[model samples]
Target: MELGLAGRRALVTGAGKGIGRSTVQALCAAGVRVVAVSRTQADLDSLVSECSGVEPVCVDLADWEATERALSSVGPVDLLVNNAGVALLQPFLEVTKEAYDMSFDVNLRAVIQVSQIVAKSMIARGVPGAIVNVSSQASQRALANHGVYCSTKGALDMLTKVMALELGPHKIRVNAVNPTVVMTLMGKANWSDPQKAKVLLDRIPLGKFAEVENVVDAILFLLSDRSGMTTGSALPVEGGFLAT
Candidate 1:
C-alpha cells in the first residue's frame, strides 16, 4: 500500500485537467514529487495550487523542441507518464492530412520523444524507473468513426513493447494502460452528449464509462515498485469492455 513512492520524481504530460490532473494528484498523494506539463499556464497553476507536491511546467507536448528543452531543465525523472493525447473523430474519407498529423504528433510522436528524453536521463543516472503510456481500448477494438485516433493509439501500444525491450537493459520498465471511455472533460464534451453518451455506454459491459480515478489507480500501480516485474504489457482497465 505504501507504493514505496516517497521522494520519487515523476513527470506527467497533459497534467492540466481530466485524467492527467487526477494522475498528478494521485502521485502527489503517494508522496511523489510531480512535474506536471500542459500547454495552459492557468490550468497548470491551478493544478499546482490544488496538489501540494506538484511542480507545474507549461510546455506543449506537440512542440517537440520546447518539450525537450523544458524537460532538460528538470533532470532525472523516476517516472514518466505519457498521458497527453488528442482525438479527432471523422470518417476516413473526411479525415484530412492535418487531422491525421495532429493526432500522430500529440498522441504517438510526443510519447516517443518524451519517453526518449526522460528515459535517457533515467538510464544515465542508473536509476530503475518506469514509464506508463496512456493507451485506449481503441488500440485493440475498432469503432466506426475512430480510425485516426485508434491507429495512433494502436501504434503507441506497439511502441510501449519496443521501448520496454530497448530500455530493459537499463532497468527502465515500459508499460501501458488501455482504458475504455473515461468520464473526463474530453469524454463529457465528446462522448457524453445525450444520444452519444447512451450509445457509447451501451458497448461497455459494465454499462458505464470509467471514472478518472480508475485510470489513475492503474497508472500508479504500473509506476510503483509493486509492479516491478511488469514491462512490455498492455494492462487493460476497460470495465470489461474487452471481455464482452
Candidate 2:
C-alpha cells in the first residue's frame, strides 16, 4: 500500500546511526525529504553521501538553546522523529544527579522541545503532521541498573499521550515505538556477554533480539497515513517481551 508519504518533509533526530539512520533511509525510500540531525558532523556527512534527499543538521540535543536555535532554521516539516537519546546504566541507589539530568535532558526534554518546535510550525502552516518518539521496552519494564534510562523513557511515554491529546484537534498525531534490544553497534558490544544476552533473550518469546530495521518499520507505519487513526499509543516492537 502506498503510505501517502511522497513529497512530505520529515525531521529525524539521532539520524547518524542505528535505528535513526535506518529510519532516515526508510523515509527517503518512501519518497520523503528528510532532515537528519545529530551532533557528529562526520556521521551527518556520511549519511548525506549514502542517501539522497537528506539534509544534515549537526546539533547536540543535550544543549537546549543550541537545539532550539538549530531547529528554528529547519523551516517546516510534516513529520518529526524524536529519536535522539542516551542510555546511562546506573543502579537506582547509585544514580547521580548528573546522570539523571543528562538522561532526562536528551531522552525526555529534547523530545518535548523538538516536538514543540515542529508542532508549532505544523499548526502555523495548517499542516497535519506526525511525531514518532523512539522509546524503549525499558520504559514499561523495570530493568535493573537502568534506573535513569528507564525513568526518562517512561516519562517520554507519558509525554506522548499528553502531546496526542493536545495536538489531535490540530490533526497532528503523536506516538511512540518501544523496541527491545536492537543489534546496533552499541547493542552488539553491550550484549556480547553470552550470559547477559541469554538472560535478556529468555524474556522475549521470539528467542531473539530486535534489529534496527524492525524499529524503523514500526516508526514508518506510525508516521504514514496507514496509521492515521493511531495516536497516544506506545507500539511495542519488543518481540513479545512485554507480553510475557
Candidate 3:
C-alpha cells in the first residue's frame, strides 16, 4: 500500500548506522526528505552520498544544551524518530553512577528534549505530525546485565505514552516500536555467539530474531497516514519473543 509519505519531511536521530540508517534509507525510498542526526560526521557524509535529499547534522545528544541548539535548525518536520540510545550493560550490583547517568541521559532524557523541541514546532506550525520512539523488548522484560539499559528503556516507554496523550490534542500522534534482537552490524557482533543466539531463538516462537527491515517497516507504517489513528501504543517487532 502507498504510505502517502511522498513530499513529507522527517528527522531521524542516530541516523549514522544500524536501524537508524535503514530508517533514513526507507524514508527516502518512500519519497520523503530526511534530516539525519548523529554524532559522527563521517557516517553522515556517507549517508548523504548514499541518499538524496538528506541533510545530515552531527550532534552528540548527551549534551542537553548542544542537542537543543543543533535541533533548532531542523525546523518543523512531519515525522520524528527518536532512535539514538546507549546500552552500557552491567549487572545491577556493578552499575555505577556514571553508567546509570549515561544510560538515562542518552536513552531517555535526549528523547524528551528532541521530541519536545520537534513537537513544539509542529504544534506552532499547525502540522499534524507523527513521532515513533525506538524502544526495546528489554524494557518490558528483564535481561541479565542490562539493569541500567533496561531501566532507561522502561522509562522511555512511559514517556512515549505521556507524549502521545499530551500531543494528541495537537493532532500529533506518538508511538513506539519495541524490537527484539535485530540483525544490524552491531547486533551481529554482539550476538555472534552460537549458543547465545540459539538461546534467544528458542524463546521466540517464530524461532528467529528481527531484522532492521522489520523494524523499519513497522516504523514507516506508524509514520504514514495508514496509522493515522495509532497513538500511545508500543508495537512489538519481536518475532514472538514476548509471547513465551
Candidate 4:
C-alpha cells in the first residue's frame, strides 16, 4: 500500500473544501507536498491550517487568464489533480447563458488550461507525472435538471482522453475519476432537501451516497506509481449507481 508519494509535489484545484480538500489531506498524509488552489482565501487558509506541508493558493479558476498567471508562479508540479468544478441543476430551458458559460468555464475550460500549463512543465522537466480529473457520473448518465452540468463533465471526460494521447510521448498520464453523489459540503448544500435527496439516493444500487474518502481513494490510486500504465481511462467510483 505504499503509494510512493512521499516528497512528491502535487497541485490540487478546488482544494479548499469537499472532495478536493479530502484529497489534499490524503496526499499530505502520504507525505506529499501539496499546493492547494481555491477561490476563497478564508477556505484556503482553513485548509492550510488543517493540513501540514500544504501551500494554499487562492485564485478563481473560472478566470483562465488569472489562473494561468497565478499558476506560473508555483513552478513545476509532480501531480496535478484537476478537481475544481461547478454544477448547476436546473431545467434545460431555464439554464441561462451565464449559467452555462460559468459551468463550462469552471468545470471544463479551467481543467484544460491548468492541465496544459502543468503538463508542459512536467514535460520540460522530463518528469513523468499524472493528471487526475475529478469528474462525475453525470458525464455518462443524463440526469433530470442537470443538462448544463452534464455537458461540461462529458466534455471533461473526452478532454481526459485527448490529454492522454497528447502527453503520452512525454510519459505524462491523463485520466479521470468519475464519482456518484458524495457526502461533501457541496452535496449537502444541493441535496439537503428531503425530496431531492431521496430521488438521488434511490438511483444508487448501493443504497447510499459515497463518502468523500471513497472518491479520494480512487484518485490517489490513479495518481500513484502503482497505476503507472493507466491513462485515457475514466474510472468510476460510483457505488454501482451506473451499474443500476
Q: What TM-score does each of the candidates earn?
A: 0.96, 0.98, 0.98, 0.97
- In the range 1-119, model 2's lDDT, one tens digit per residue, is 67889899999999998999999999998899999999999999999999977999999999999998999979989999999999889888899999998999999999999999999
lDDT of 1: 0.90
Model 1 pairs in collision: none
Q: What is the alpha-carbon lDDT of model 2 when measured against the actual structure? A: 0.94
Off by over 4 Å in 4: none
Tens-place lDDT per residue, model 3, 92-173, is 8898999988889999999999998999999889989999999999989899999999889899899999999999999999
Q: What are the C-alpha RMSDs, in order, of all predicted structures?
A: 1.2, 0.8, 0.7, 1.1
Candidate 2 vs candidate 4, lDDT winner? 2
Write model 4 residue lDDT over 21-68, tens digit each, in one string. 999999999999999999999998888889966888899999978998
Superposed Cα RMSD, model 2:
0.8
Name model 2 segments beyond 4 Å from true. Answer: none
In model 3, the runs with Cα more than 4 Å from the true position are none
Cα deviation at 57, candidate 4, in Å, is 1.1
Better of 1 and 2 by TM-score: 2
Residue 222 shift from truth in candidate 1, angstroms: 0.4
